[model samples]
Target: MYDLHCHLLPAIDDGPADLETSLEMARMAVADGITTVACTPHIYPGVYENTAYGIRAAIRAFQCELDQRGIALRLVEGADVHLAPDLIEGIQAGRIPTIAGSRYLLLEPPHHVAPPRFEETVFDLMVAGLVPVITHPERLSWIETHFDLFERLAMRGAWMQITAGALTGRFGKRVKYWSERFVGDGMCMIIATDAHHPRRRPPCLMEAREAAGALVGGEEATNQVVIRPRGIVNDVPPSDLPAAALRTCPRDQRNANGPIRASVFGRLLGRKTGV
Candidate 1:
């Protein structure tokens, strides 16, 4: 499996603080059946302040360490980039790195207030020939009201990356509901670990992959975790991949109060409640 979004680099933002922790995260990721992970740490100005040059240096050093330790996982370059007025310039200047140096970039929106001209900004990115893979929209607190925005973005050629843990109930019922909704409605393009640690935000996608298979199908789930991610890392354009297949979620077909076990995740994850 290829995890396109991960925060495993040491001392580079909210990822593992040290090399030991980072290595442990790698081992955990490998155990979870992940072979390559794009080390995408946060790149918010005045906070993470991570740049393309710095991220490359970290990847080179980290790769050497992994080789010394005999870890087989491969590291790639990316950044969880926040929206900026000069983002297009930054990307054009090579100050920002895309996914594995692909045209796809992990675009993180504000968690609280909706940013000004968000859609326009994203369209600008697409105009610049950069694909913005919106990260963790299910976990966004405002998704309940702005749910239609996701669908609109998808229709306009943007892609959404729903977090893996959100489907496994690691985040709460609210997030799980949206996660299922996005998958059921075919608004999400991929499911990534967005993993930061071995335990807290552990590097695991096998469970979510299974859950997605149950929601969509085995083949489509494979596209999300393996085929499509590989294409992104290899710089394959989005138009080259299969179109997202939309399907009604069984929960909505049944009822809102219906048990989730017979529907999206509870049945797959061995849970007891709905939502």
Candidate 2:
């Protein structure tokens, strides 16, 4: 499998602190069935402060380490870019790194609160000809109340990537619940491991894929974890990618008023569960 989001670079951000830990993480990923991993270190300006050039250099060094260790995992360049006012300027100046230098960018929203003009900023990035792949929205607190915002973003050509751990209840029951809901409702397009270490938040997705397969069927679950991710890394357009057989809840199982809620093991197939 190809993991499109991971923090495997050493001393770059909140990932591994040294090369040894990074190498260990790489081995863990390979054992977990991840052949390719995008080294998406955080690019928060005042915090991580990772520039495109620096990220590229870091990826090169890490790749060499993997090669020397005889690890089969491949590292690609990317940034978990925090939303900012100067985002467009940063992209224009080539200071922001996209996934594998493709048009796909891993855009990370604030976890505590939704930023002001969030929709406008996403649209502006789209207008600038960049595909903003929203990372881990199921973990966002405001999504429970403003879930429609995500549907709108999808209509505007944005892609949503849910963390693999979120599906296995690693973040919490709430995040896991929403992750399943989003996948069933067809809002989420990819699953990635936002892995930070070898043990805690480790690089793994097979278990999550099995969990997702129970809802969307084995085939569609594979599309989320493998097919779409490969397309994003290769800069493939959404129309050209494979379609997911979205499963919906039975009519009697749906809620009457707002969103349709699915049981923990039940399918919420094609129905539109409102925000």
Candidate 3:
């Protein structure tokens, strides 16, 4: 299997703290049947501040280390890029690296709110000949209420990636509920570990694949984790994707509760609460 999103590089952003831990994460990935992993460290300016050249260098170093240790897993260069006003400029300047040098880019939206003109930004990316793969929309609170936004994005040539843990209920019941809906609706085009460590949030894809298979069928699940990811890394257009089901999620399967409620008072008190 090819994992298109993971933060396994040492000392980069919030990934493994050191090389030893990174190697352990690789071992865990291999045990989970992953052969290729894209080292997608966060590329948030003024925060992670990871450039394309630096990510490439880090991937080369990690690849050499894996080779020295006889680990068969292959590391590829990429970034989980935070959306910014200068995103197109950064890509044009080669500051942002696409997935394995493909036209596919892993685009991360802000967790708390969808940026203004988000669809237009994605449209601009497509116009610039880059495919923006939106990461982890199921975890975003606003998307639960405005699901048509995601469907519109899909229609505008954007892709969605669901985290493996979210599908398997590792994040929580809320995230899993949405993840299932996305997969069932064919809005989620890929499933990746988004692994950050060896254990908690470990590199595990098979469990999620099995869970997805129960909804979409085994072959379709394989395509999500294997075929589509391989195509992204190899710069090929995704093929044999599961056809969108004509049936929407049953009413009973839909969340009865409304969107996650965030309190302005809680924010003023410096306390965070959600359900």
**What tens-digit string does per-residue lDDT give for candidate 3 at 1-275?**
98999999999999899999999999999988999999999999899999999999999999999999999999898999998889999998999999999999999988888689988899999999998999999989787777888877875668889999999999999999999978876677789998998888799999999998877667668878988888898888643334332113344654455212222223323543222
Which 10-residue window of candidate 2 scores lowest in summed lDDT? 261-270
Output the number of the lDDT-best candidate. Answer: 1
Clashing pairs in 1: none
Over 4 Å off in model 2, which ranges?
A: 248-275
Better of 1 and 2 by lDDT: 1
lDDT of 2 by residue, 71-113 (tens): 9998888999998889989988999989998889999999989
Question: Which lDDT value does model 3 have at 4?
Answer: 93
Tens digit of per-residue lDDT, candidate 1, span 1-275: 99999999999999899999999999998888999999999989888889999999999999999999999999999999999888899999999999998999999999987777899999999999988999999999888888877777877889999899999999999999999888866677888999888899999999999988888777778888999899999999887986554443466564566423222222333433432
Q: What order do candidates take by TM-score, descending? A: 1, 2, 3
Superior candidate under TM-score, 2 versus 3: 2
Which regions of candidate 3 fall more than 4 Å away from where they truly are? 238-275
Sort the predicted structures by lDDT, highest score first. 1, 2, 3
Candidate 1 Cα outliers beyond 4 Å, as residue runs: 248-275
Please report how far candidate 3 places residue 121 from its true position, in Å. Answer: 0.5
Select the stronger candidate by TM-score from 1 and 3: 1
Candidate 3, run of 10 with poorest lDDT: 258-267
